[model samples]
Target: PSRSATLAALDVRKRRDFTVHDLDHRHHLWHEGDDARRWAREAAKRATVVLGNIEEVEMATGTRNPVAGAAALLDLGAKIAIVKRGGEGVYARTASEEVTVRPVEIPVLNGLGAGDAFGGALCHGLLAGWPLRRTLEAANAAGAIVASRLACADAMPTLAEIETVLARKVSA
Candidate 1:
């Protein structure tokens, strides 16, 4: 599915189902193919939140630097932009603020579905009206927890589990 189309569709239902709308563009695997890159510009303009990995951010903003790509996304009209940096960490920006949450140190296992965990946690944080910095920290923990486990969906960590990891880190 195209993030552009998905965000557009969700925009219509914004009054009913969701308050915060987010777009997560892909590099090229989406239905729009190469055109998806062009579509991302419009998608970022339409969405209040834009979240994607480095490649997706680069594809959407037509920029090489991930940080600059995130800034471009916000300039295109997104109220916030989140760039997932995998092992490096995650960077997020809004009109008023920006934050970079470090990756949680953990044993590696399977890497599949980590993005799902990260995105899910991001949505959860947004829906709950948490600050972007706090949200990214939790989201980072969620992805790390999933990556440190054996599988993806089956290993998706609960908020409690994520907090536990964070708690341990805070204490250590």
Candidate 2:
């Protein structure tokens, strides 16, 4: 997975409003800093929303600098920079402020793709015109829904499930 960051970034660049700037630039098992930063600068030039996993970004960038990462997005004039922290929470940054949305309580079944689902749903929610708070809440709910199930792709929550959880009317 480490070696695929570039491909992933390319896909995001082509398909989405985001482009991944892998701090790790080379196709090697380990990342090359200059190459990563170069590519990141390029990604920042294109995308408005940047999504990254803490692990992948750190591995490629060779440094776990959230502020620097945030700065990159800022330099690119991105509106949102989302940093996914598994089990801990999700961090979101805009030009003016940064918010860390804590995770909801849910049993962990399979951790794989939880972050992807969260990012997808988060972006979807925002695109659907949900407020930032509601978007983060929905993303949090999506993460919980995936965690509650046994498989990764199969575990992704439906829109109804996300709304039900975000609504907070359903009891355990």
Candidate 3:
């Protein structure tokens, strides 16, 4: 779906269900896609958060430099911009802070939707009003858990399970 149209929909639906107000974009840039920037800007006006696939950003923008892109989003007023870096971790930024959360080391089985899982967990944490550090930690643990197991959505750990990993210092 087009970003601008998506943003318009979110604006209407936000009051009813904030959980469904996720901002997703295909990881590509249109160079001509000024609409995306405008959408991001508009969502920022409503204090919306942005989550995205890193590969799409790299392929479309011709760069994987999430920091730069995040800066653009921040400038446009996004409350937070999360860029999933797969095995490395997640890069997140807000108007006041920037954070690079490293993934916990774990044996990998299959890598699919790990980034989305991490982003989803982070969104959950935000919804719960967790602090940024705790949110990143929870998100990282969730991604690591998903990476270590073979199943798709089934690999994602429960909050209790993630907390267990967070408490340990396991070497991957």
Q: How accurate is candidate 2 locally (lDDT)?
A: 0.65
Which tens-of-lDDT digit does each residue in 42-90 have in candidate 3? 6544544665557544433335689876665555446676676766777
Candidate 2: tens digits of C-alpha lDDT, residues 1-172 = 5425655555556635433332322345444544655555555555566666665445434446765665555666567766666676777788787877777777887877676677778778777887776787788789888877889987889899888876662354
- TM-score for each model: 0.85, 0.70, 0.72
Model 3, residue 168: distance off in Å is 2.1
What's the lDDT for all of these models?
Answer: 0.77, 0.65, 0.67
Q: Highest TM-score: which candidate? A: 1
What stretches of model 3 exceed 4 Å from their correct place? 1-8, 14-47, 59-63, 170-172
Clashing pairs in 3: 27-56, 27-57, 28-60, 29-60
Error of 2 at 73 (Å): 2.2
Worst 10 residues of 1 by lDDT: 14-23
Task: List ranges where model 2 is wrong by over 4 Å.
Answer: 1-34, 59-68, 168-172
Ranking by TM-score: 1, 3, 2
Tens digit of lDDT per residue, candidate 1, span 100-166? 8887889889888888888889889878888788788898999899999998899999999999998
